[model samples]
Each structure stands twice: as structure tokens, then as C-alpha cells.
Target: MNISIHSFTLKLRDPFRISYESRNEQEALVIQLSDTNQQGQTVTGLGESTANNYYQVSIERMQKEVALVRERIEEYSLANEVLNAGQVGTPGHLWQQLQPELQHSSFTLCAIDVAAHDLYGKKVGQPLYKLWGLNPADAPTTNYTLGIDSIEVMIRKMQAKPWPIYKIKLGTPEDLAIVRELRKHTNAVFRVDANCAWGVDETIENAQELKKLGVEFIEQPLKADNWDGMKEVYQHSALPLIADESCIVEDDVAKCAGHFHGINIKLTKCGGITPARRMIREAQRHNMKVMIGCMTESTIGISAIAHLSPLLNYVDMDGALLLAEDIATGVTITTDGVHFPDENGTGVQLLTPSPTSLV
Candidate 1:
């Protein structure tokens, strides 16, 4: 098997603003796994992950980690002749073996894990959702995001797309004012994400104001490690709390059971579909709602998250929707929701090679 990595900077359609920062671009790494058979039939699988500075995974760090992971995979394939590209191992086995080395770099591991799943899905001639027996109707409607900006600017952004569901970024003094202002323009459902910027008392006050504005939920209002603060808000706030930075992996879900009403699972945060599926099940087992979210990625990464939409409660896999330019094709996003194409694997195809390379 041949493994290669490509790096690219995805330009955002608009400046994406969270409480922590704002950006017009994001860094991403694409991983491809390929092998040619005796008949000269070459099969290639692709996966991508965006590197987020907020998550502590920088572009340089992710690139270095990918190289290390690729070298390790090559060594394992050489040492174990039984593990071929076709019959490498179950997702569980593959992950268990690499967990120790890849544990700290979930974002990097996500790219490899997604690529492997793409390869296996293609070999089996089925999409991952179909393979997992998920129904298309069960997939939830996705929410388009509105970042922090002046009242006029933010309102203009909202009016441009006018998606049914909108995720509004908060944490500024105008957090409630933003919602109140948008409410005057449209009757769209709203979800607010504070990006872990408020204190417990402030979150309670904000939640009360948001609930009155008919905001659906509040996401990560307090800091990630502020368990006590989150619990305090969850105990009294009118809106349900959804964990983003607070819930990074499956284990985090267990710890966040009573503190948060729902958990936001991102492929970049949890590693890949394999672990993400596990996290969903775990969250469900704890009687918590599940949301599948994403970084500002391209079709390659966002499409990977879309495959698991059937298992999600609230879908925010609109990372690709925010891109000014996309290099892959597959899923289609509309005001209604996301629709997948009839293709094997993750239903994504790279239209062109990334022009950038790892320096």
C-alpha cells in the first residue's frame, strides 16, 4: 500500500468568528491510501482533517504527526504480511493497535481512519451509511452558522443564505442583542454557541435571555474545564446545554452526563467515524442527545461527517458549506438539509490535487 499526504489552506466564504478568534482561512491535511493489484487496478481512498489552533493542533504539528503515522503504518504493513490493504483488519483492531501512538493526535488519526473506511467501503461497493444500516430520513437538518459581527453585517450574512436553522456565535456584549435583532428579521430557529467564553452566572443570565428569544439551545458557554460552572448552569438554565470543547472524546461524554444535555461529536476531535460512532452510542446510552459537528473543512472532511448523519440528533456538519472554494464533490447542502450522492465509500471525489505541499 502507498500512503501520501497533501496539505492545503481552505479559504472561508466569510470570516468565521468564534468567541476565541476569527479567521478567513483554515489549514487542512488530506491523506490518501492506495494500492495496485496484479491486474493493475489501482484503488485509492481519501480522507481530510482541518488543523485547529484552538484545539491545540497546529498545521505544522499535524503535518509532523501525519508523517510519523504514515511511517508507522508502513512499518506495520511490512512486518505483518498477513495485513494486506484488502484485509487489513477490522476498524476496531486497526484503531486499537494505533491508539497508543495516535492517542494524542486525534485529528491526525481521523484522516487515516476516514481514508481506511473509504477504502473498505469502496472495496465492498457500498456507502458507509448504507453499510451501517442507517436510514436517510433519520438524518437531521443542518444549521448554517452566523459569526460575530456588527448588527448590520451579521444581519446581511443571515439574509444572504436564510437557512432554516442557524447557529449564532456569541460571547460578545451583543450576544443577546444579536439574537433579538435577527429574530426581528426572520422566524428561523436559532442555536447559540458561546465557544466557552462566559462564566456560570453569565451563562445563566444569557440562557434566560436566549430562552425568551426562543433560542433552541446554548453550546459550551463556560470554559472546557469548567465542570462546576457548566453543572451550575445546567441545573438552572431554561435551555439545554450542549457540550463542544467540553466533550472531546467518548470518555468525556460519560463525565459530562449530568452537566450537559447533549454532546457535540466532531470527527476531528474524536479521531474518526469508528470512535465517533462509539461516542454517539455512549451518549445515547447516557440518555443524552447527540450532535455531529465539524471544523471549517472542505467537502472531503465535511462529507465524511455527513455519512453518520442518520445517527445524529442535531447536525452541524456545515464546515464545507462555509468554504469559499472546495476541492471535492459528493454531498449537496440546501436550505432543507444535506443530501448524499449515490456513490460507494463516503460519496466524495477529489476534483483536483491540492496545489500546496508540506514544507
Candidate 2:
């Protein structure tokens, strides 16, 4: 059994803007696990979104868990048992069986699942989606995001493009005025992502106000833990609510089942594709709609999500659309929506890191 880890920097195609802030580049960590079996060999690769302390946590955990997963893979190999890739319930149990010192690391638990899936995908020669029973042809239409900018600037940005649907970032009451002005420009089916910036009363009032302006949904209007407020807003507001920060982990879905009408599942927040798929299924079981989303990731991460977006109820994978230039290949997003990779596996092409100045 062997494990290796490497860190890479993913430069954004442009200065990615959101309700929180903007960034120019993203750093990523890739972990690979391998077992020595000349006749029946297995290898797995997992990537984590890099930026600030987020990757730091996953990277440190990956460093610690790589050896443990390697040992587990070796033991499984020796037992000659079929290593199921889509076995979600097994890993949770296996993690608990580990030593008490290694019991509570979320990153380790997440990395184990990712590695298992990657290895399974390689062995079966099928993409992750195929293993999960998703079709590439049925990819969902994604909404292009408009960052927190002046109404005029946002309008100009929209005018310069031809995206049918757009999502506006709204964090303050001032955004209400922006939405009002935006309504005068185009009648596109628009959504709002408040990013947990509003309170219960404010979200309720804003949703009511925006309802008349043809806004489609209000995402994460209140804080993640504000379940009572979210339920109150959901009951009284005409606008549909989508959860973002509130539903970070799969288990969190049950907590928000009645509070939000929909959830925005980002691969990073859910740890990776394995947990993300589980989250989608859990959301469906609870009758909550799904929105496939992304962090400020490059095409590698977005491409991974694009493969699964077609099966989701809503898609907000415009993270690459906001960039000025992309790493090229894997997935392509047109004004209409996103397109999945035609190749087997994740369909993400990792390009040779180039020397380019950050915008």
C-alpha cells in the first residue's frame, strides 16, 4: 500500500466575484492512493478546492488519513472482497471502527470516500456519473451568476452576453433597489443569492418585495443555523428559498428539510463528488429540490460537477463563467447553459500549469 499527495495552484479565468468578495486564483490539493497488486491493481485520486484555510484543513487531514486509507485498502485487498465505490454507508461505519484518535476528522472521512470512488471508477473504466446512474446527455441548464455590482454595471454585463438565466448576488437591502432597476432592463428568469446575509424579518420582507420583480428564488437568505427564522420566512414568503451555507454536509440536509424549499450543493462543501451524490439523493428523499453549485474553482472542479448537474433540479455552475479566462477543456459553458465532457471518468483534463500573471 502506498499514498502520495501533491499541491497545485488553479488560476481562475477571471476575478471571481460573489456576495462575499472576489478572488483571482485558487489552490488545490490532489491526493492519490495506490495498492500493489500486479494482476488486480487499483489507484485513486482526489482533489480539494484551495483557498485560505479551507484547503489547509483538508490538506492536513489528507496527510494524516492517507496512510490509514492505504492500510485499509491493503486489508481489503488481502481479504479479496469486492470494493464497492458507491457504498456510502460502509465508510461511515468503517470510520467509526478506526482507532478513537482518528474518529472525528471530517476530512479523513471525506477523503476515504473520494479515494474509494476514484479507485472504483478506474477499475470499472466508467466515469463517476455512470457509476452513480447519471446520463451526460441530460445535463441541466445552469444559471450564470451576476456578482454584487451596481444595477447599471450588472445590466451592462448582461447586455454584453446572451445567457437566458442569471443569478444576482444580494447581501444588503440596497440590493432591492438594484433588483428593481434590473427588472427594467431584462425579463430573464433571475434568482438571488443572499449568501446568508439577511435575517428572518429582512428575508421575508425582501422576498415579498422581489416576488413582484420576477425573481425566481432567494438563496441562503439567513444564517445557516437560523432554522427557526428560515422556517418562518419560508412559511410567510412568496419567493422560494434555496439553502447554500446551511447545507454543508449530507446530514445537515435533514435538519433543513422543512426549512428550505431547495439546496445548493457545492462539491467542496460536501467534501467531493461521493458525498455530493449522497447529498443529492438525501435531498430528493426529503422532497427538497437540488441545485448543483461550485466554489471559485477552476474547470477541473467545475467539470466534475457538470457531469452530475444534468440530474439536479437546478444548476448554478457559473463559477467558470465569471472568470476572464479558463484553463481550457473538460467542460464548456455557453450562453444557454453548461455542457458535460464526452469522455469516460470525470471528463476533467488537468492542464500543465502555465506561468501567467494573475488578473
Candidate 3:
């Protein structure tokens, strides 16, 4: 068993501004796991996790977390020669084994869990989506994000991309005004995300007005801990509400059941595909709409999100599309839709060789 780590500073085409924060550069940790499988094939799998100030996750912290378990990880993999051989030792089982060291940093846990799944898929010679029996044709169209900017600049972005759906970030006083103005230019479907910036009354009011402008849904209007407030808005708001920060892990799914109409699971937030699959199933059991989103990451993370699209009602995997340049090659998302590469394991190949170390 071998592990290699590399970090990159991903430059965005424009400064990505959500309600809580804005960033021009995103720091990402991409790791590769190599091991000879039971069939004696050397396979390497890729995984990614980005630094997020909102979540208080830093590259230094993730690196330390990985270092803490480095020896155990290698030893465990070596001892269990057929570690990921079959369902007996799945990604979920691996996640449990590493939980003690990585539990403090979901970002770190996500990277390893995703890499393990990618490795398993490659060992079996199948993509994760295909292995799960999902059809690419059933996947939903992903929406391109438009950060907060002047209405004129926003309109220009809309004109430039001309996508089928646009996720318009809102939190300013001129929120509806921006949407109304952008609506005049194109008939593209609009989805508004306040990023936990609106109040209960404000959310209800905006929902009614935004619904009239063809806005499909509202995402994380109030603060994540404001369940009392969300209850009132959920019942009164004209548009459906999707929870982002409110739903972090599998346990949060049931907690968000009555307050939110759906959930937007970020792979990094929920600790990758293994637990994310459980989160999706739990959300479905509660009869809630399920969505998967991405941060301003490279194709390594975005490609992992793409394979989960077939299980979602909505998708926000346009993270890589907003990049000025990408560091890896994987599933490609274009204006038309997502295109998977002709290879397996999220179809990711780093454009450059891994660095000696990211510390």
C-alpha cells in the first residue's frame, strides 16, 4: 500500500462570493492511493478535499489529520491483503476504521473515503456510478453558479455561459431586483441560494416574489442552527427550501426532515461517497428531494460529484467550470451537460505529477 499527497491552489475565473464569504483562490488536497489488489493488479485511486473557511477547515489541519493516521492506514492495508476485495470490507468499513483519527476533520475523512471508493471501483474495472447500477441518461442537468455582483456584471455572465439553469447567489438588499433584471435577458431557469442570509419573514417574502420570476427553489435561507425559524419559513414560503449547512452528516438528515423540503449534500461536508450514499437514502426515506453540490474545486472533486448525479433531483457540480485552469482531467461538465471519460475510478488523471509533499 502506498499513499501520495499533493496540494494545489485553484484559481477561479472570478472571485466566488457566497453570502458568508468570498474567495479568489481555493486550496485543495488531492491524494492518490496505490495498492496491489487481490487480482495482483496495481491500481491507484484519486480523491480531493478543499479548504473552507466557513467550515473552519484548513489545509494544515487536514494534513495533520492525515499524518496522524498515516502509519495505521498503511499497516491496516498491508495486513488485510484483500482489504477492499469484496463487500466484506467495503468503503464504509474502511471509513469506520479511520474514523477515530479523521473524525475531527470531515474534510480529511472525505478525501480518504472517496479515494477508497475510487480504488475499489478501479479494482473491479467499473465506474462508481455504473457499479451502483445508475444510468447517465437519468442524471439531472447541473446549474452554473453566478456569484453576487452588479446586475450588469451578472447579466454579462449569464450571456457568456447561456446555461440551462443558473444558481443565482443572493443576500444583498437588491436580491430580487438582481434576479428580475437578469430574468429580462434570458429565459434560463433560476435557483436562488441565500447561503443562510435571510430571516424567516424575509425568506417567505422572497420566496413568493422569486417564485413569480420563475425561480425554482431557495437554498439555506436562514442560519443552519435556526430550526425554529426554518419551521415557520418552510410552512409559509411559496418556494421549496433546500438545506445546506443544516444537513452535514447522516444524523442531520432526520433532524432536517420537517424543516426543509430537501437537502443539498456536499461530498466534502458529509465525508465522501460512502456516507453520502447513506445520507441520500435516509433523505429519501423521509420523502425529501436530494441534491449534490460542489465547492470551487478542480475536476478531481467535481468528477466525484458527477458520478452521484443520477441519484439527485438537482445538482450544483459546476465547480470546475468556474476555474481559470484545471489541475486534473476527469469527468467534464459543459454547457450542454456532463461528459464522463472513457476510463474508470472517477476518470481522474492529474495533469501534473504529484509533488514530493504538500506540507
Model 3, C-alpha of 332: deviation from truth (Å): 0.9
Model 1 pairs whose backbones collide: none
| Candidate 2 residue spans exceeding 4 A from truth | 1-4, 32-46, 52-119, 353-359
Scored by TM-score, the top model is 3
- lDDT leaderboard ranking: 3, 1, 2
Error of 3 at 153 (Å): 1.0
Ten-residue segment with the worst summed lDDT in candidate 2?
A: 77-86
Question: TM-scores, in order shown?
Answer: 0.94, 0.80, 0.95
Off by over 4 Å in 3: 38-41, 78-88, 354-356
Candidate 1, residue 207: Cα displacement in angstroms equals 1.5
lDDT of 3 by residue, 1-359 (tens): 57877888888998888787888989999878888766787888889999999889988888888888787666655222334423445666778888876776789989988888778677767887887889987789999999998899998988988899999999999999999999999898999999999999999999999999999999999999999999999889999999998999989999999999999999999888888988999999999999999988799999898999999999999999999999899899887678999887788888987543673
Candidate 1, residues 133-241, lDDT tens digits: the string is: 8887778989999989888899999999888899999889878788999999988899999998889999888888889887999999999999988878899998999
Predicted structure 1: lDDT: 0.83
> How would you encode candidate 2's per-residue C-alpha lDDT over 1-359 as one tens digit per residue?
34455555556543555656666666555544454333475544344354445334544454556555556544543112334642332332343344244434444444444444444444455666776687766777788777776667778887776677888888855888988888888878889999778888888888888989999899898878888888899899888899988988778889888899988887666666666778988999999999978765656566667777867988877766665565535678786566656554455544654343211
* C-alpha RMSD values across all candidates: 3.0, 4.7, 2.1
